[model samples]
Target: MTIFWTIVGIAIFFVGLLISIAWHELGHFATARWFGIKVPEFMVGFGRTIWSVKRGETEYGIKAIPLGGYVRMIGMLPPAPGKTLGRSRRTGPFQGLMDDARAQSRLDVLPEDADRQFWTRSPWKRIVVMFAGPFMNLILAVGLFAVLLMGVGQATDGTRIRDVSECVVPASVAATQEVEQCPVDAPPTPAAGAGLLPGDRVVSFAGRAIEEAQGQQLREAIRVASGPTPIVVDRDGVRVTTSVNIIDNEVQDFQDSTRTVTAGFIGVSLLPDYVRQGPGTVATEIGSMIVRTGEAITKIPERVPAVFGAAFLGEEREPDSPVGVVGVSRIGGEILAQENVPWQQDVSLFLGLLAAVNISLFLLNLLPIPPLDGGQIVPAIWESIKRNTARALGRPDPGPVDAARLLPVAYVFVLVFLGFSLILAIADIVNPVPFFG
Candidate 1:
């Protein structure tokens, strides 16, 4: 049953991925048509075409590989200097590359497409067309997050006691054991000694009530107390007051396990709680996700060594480390196979994963490197700047910045990206990170 659900989860994620890819290409396709650019193909994948149909001048299709997709727009790059379409007679050091790029850009150029080439459009229109793809991913991410956070709600902990600890032990000792039960020589937990039971709704701790959601006051009071502290609970509709002897215990630091601090301890776990968030909270979460993802993307170069070590050597991969498409899909499968997980929780987690994937897509494609949407955008922006400067200096419009000239750079970008992707893929397969554990 677990295996069946896991396969189902992978299939669901793959379908979601295809939808995301198609949605991204649709952005480019729709905007290119809107700006009068000749779109020759709108494909949902790469490599050998599985199916296709010609509609007007454009061919819509699906391909074998489901990794990525693209829309082929006419004249994506301006012609090479002193070179015309189908009459390329140049072979300088890198001239042939630029010429080939220009030639390929004109592959679907018909007589009417002369005016419909992407380069013929205004720079602003080109920018819009290029920007639309990433924007679609951003829209999908926000919508998913809104549905998960506002509609489904986030799981948290409440003030009610789920379980009372049997023994008092240092966090260092607790970390070494699977279940820290009361030893014959060890003392019982403060909550256990104080006669606190499961299902007790903690009304106040040391005169402090629930400060914020998730029983913040109780946590703070437990951490700060030095000795016996007064606690009030509502047990079975009756208010009960009790005192617990707080013990000085070694607690593990939240960020670093090597570090420890002495704090008050009264061992009791909180009951499961959930709080449905508002638009403001969802927006905040989205902003944080974007910032965190951007930081992670920037750290990719630094992480290559770690990825290499994990893939080649026997080093364990970090839980929060970067993952490729394969890694994320495996994680989706794992999420579905989790033992005893509720259906709603599984769906929520799947939605969250999809949202994260879209967020990553939004950020990665916006990078100012060639072959990506951002690369095309850079040329358009430069063209706009040059045209404005020419108007100011009483010069003629220099025309579209010869994007063909950057063909070599774009090729390099593709190679580097391919190399990085290959490494991540290998690492994902060999040393997959335990995302949840």
Candidate 2:
């Protein structure tokens, strides 16, 4: 059963990842189509096609790898030579015959000089097409976060005390007279060597029902007990009766702004009750999450430099390293194992995390590094500026870019990025600092 559930969880996580990737690529595809660009192929994933079908001029397909997707647009980049014809041999007898036949067969097709080709479109239009993918990813992240916040509501664990040292304890009024030492911790404290297991729920103390107000009274009863006081707890829905000895102690209640006079130390943590939210409350909570996520992203540059410097210098630093697929899968499994978390709630949380990941991917890709969209846009902008200057000087616009000169630089940058990603992936696997942890 555990294995089955783990597999299901992994499958769900992978599906979500793929959907996020597809949504991002869909943005590019849609924008290209809107501009009347010739989209020769629209594909999800990379590598050889696993499934494909031609729809009008576009060949839509799914690839073998689900890591990323793309839409290949005609004239967006240099065109490849025909299967048997080399680029330099475009006018050979055989090539000429084939070209003539191809040209004649497509007599109704739009001429090559048509403005629909991506290169013929204005530079601003091209920029829009390039940026749409990342923009869509950001939109998806915000939407997912909003939905999750609205659906599940937001609550903090009671263990995180809003007011320091202030706590509610249970006691019986009739049995307990003057309080001596109250139980400091409910289940177990580090000092007492007592600990609460996963499924324990407090029932009552000294025959008194454990209510919100009566908790303090119960502490007094425990303090006054001559010997071990009887305590009742429900574990996994089964009632278990036990005795806990209490030690006398004076504790400060910061919330009350006073010291509590009590006895007996029973070490247990306070657990918070969930407060459900209405639609309006949910909207507010979601908005808060979005704001927080945005702020966190903005801090990455500052935080990442410090972290990397610490690692390089071998200095003592917080172990908040990145986690790769292995770590994420482990988290998904653990979340699935947790009891009382509704399926929809779990799905919503998972999707929110996935969206955040996509947002990161989108932002990372926009860095002005070679082989990225930003990198390509940089040169395009420079060329556009040069062309405008030349036009003002009454000179002819520079001829089209020579692809041979750019390919080598792009290839080198891609290799460097791939190498860096591999290093990070290895680091993540060996030294994972989980997000939830």
Candidate 3:
């Protein structure tokens, strides 16, 4: 059953990925066609063609690899300056008999014409064609998120609390009638040393029914305990009894005006769980995902350096550092395997993640780095601005860009990006961090 679910999850993930890529490419193809640009080929994936069919002047095909798709349009980028236009002539008797001899001849080359070319289009048209793909991705993400939000209600969980320790105020402060009590570094100091494990919920201490106030009292008792005392805890719904003797320990809880005081100590933490609600929808979920993703992206510059430093220093960083495709698939599989999560809830979560991934892809592609959609758009914008400047100064238009010089730089950048991506892929495969861990 686990294997079956894993396979299903992987299949669904790939399907979503393919849809994203195709939707993005479709935007480009549609826009290019709208502007009368001659699209030579529209294909999903790359490398050797698996299937193909020619329609009108374009060949639509699916390629072997499913990583990405593309729309090959004539005059996509600046053409080579030295390349001459091909001229065709027919001398056979069949040429004079047929008026459309040039069009019929498979061996004949067609001359390049300005009117039918993408380069001859206005700057606005070119911009629209280039921007359409990422724009479509963004739209798709937003739409999915909206659907999710509408299907599922938004609610905060206990995990969202900034500090679990602060949830309960120190009894010492309450005793003193102070508005704010000095924080205590009181450790779990389990009343008994019965080998209590981490994540064991303190259901009661000394049989006092451990509510918030009772738990605080237990902590105070442990702080003053000089001898072994009994402890009781709940581990995943199983009751466990333990005992611990408090040893003299000094720790700082909060840094305030003057001094730090010593408090009881234990080394266990409470695990937090999400409080589920049913007011979520596709739209709302997508929106929430977008907002969270944007916030995450904004913090990257501040966070990446710290992450790298911790990794270098061999610090125990959180297991949920960064996840790639493998991590996502594993999480998807886990979600599918869990019996408690309802089918609609599972679908909502999957769609929400899909929206987030698509949004990230859209933003990444819009970065003005080499070999990206934005990279190409930058030059086009510059060209337009330069032409406008020349016109204002009463000069002739500066001619097309030198594609030769830029193409090499673009190629090198693409190679570097691919290498970096390969490294990430390896990391993802070897150490897939589970999302729900």
Q: Give candidate 1's TM-score.
A: 0.83
TM-score to native of every candidate shown: 0.83, 0.60, 0.61
Model 2, 368-413: lDDT tens per residue?
6545666555656766777888899999987443232354566677
Candidate 2, which ten residues in sequence have the lowest lDDT sum?
158-167
Predict model 3's lDDT versus the native. 0.61
lDDT of 3 by residue, 41-141 (tens): 88988789999999998898889876568887766544434433422243444423332322232122236544556666777787788799989988988
Number of the top lDDT candidate: 1
Every candidate's lDDT:
0.85, 0.58, 0.61
lDDT by residue (114-197, candidate 1, tens digit) is 999888899999999999999999999999989988888877656888778898777878776766456788789999999999
Q: Relative to the unseen true structure, what is the C-alpha lDDT of residue 327 in candidate 2, on a scale of 0 to 100?
A: 50
Candidate 2's C-alpha runs over 4 A off are 78-114, 158-319, 325-330, 339-345, 387-406, 423-437
Q: Which prediction has more favorable lDDT, 2 or 3? A: 3
TM-score preference between candidates 1 and 3, better one: 1
Q: Which candidate's TM-score is highest?
A: 1
How accurate locally is residue 226 in candidate 1, as Cα lDDT from 0 to 100? Answer: 71
- Give the poorly placed runs of model 3, Cα more than 4 Å off: 80-109, 112-114, 155-322
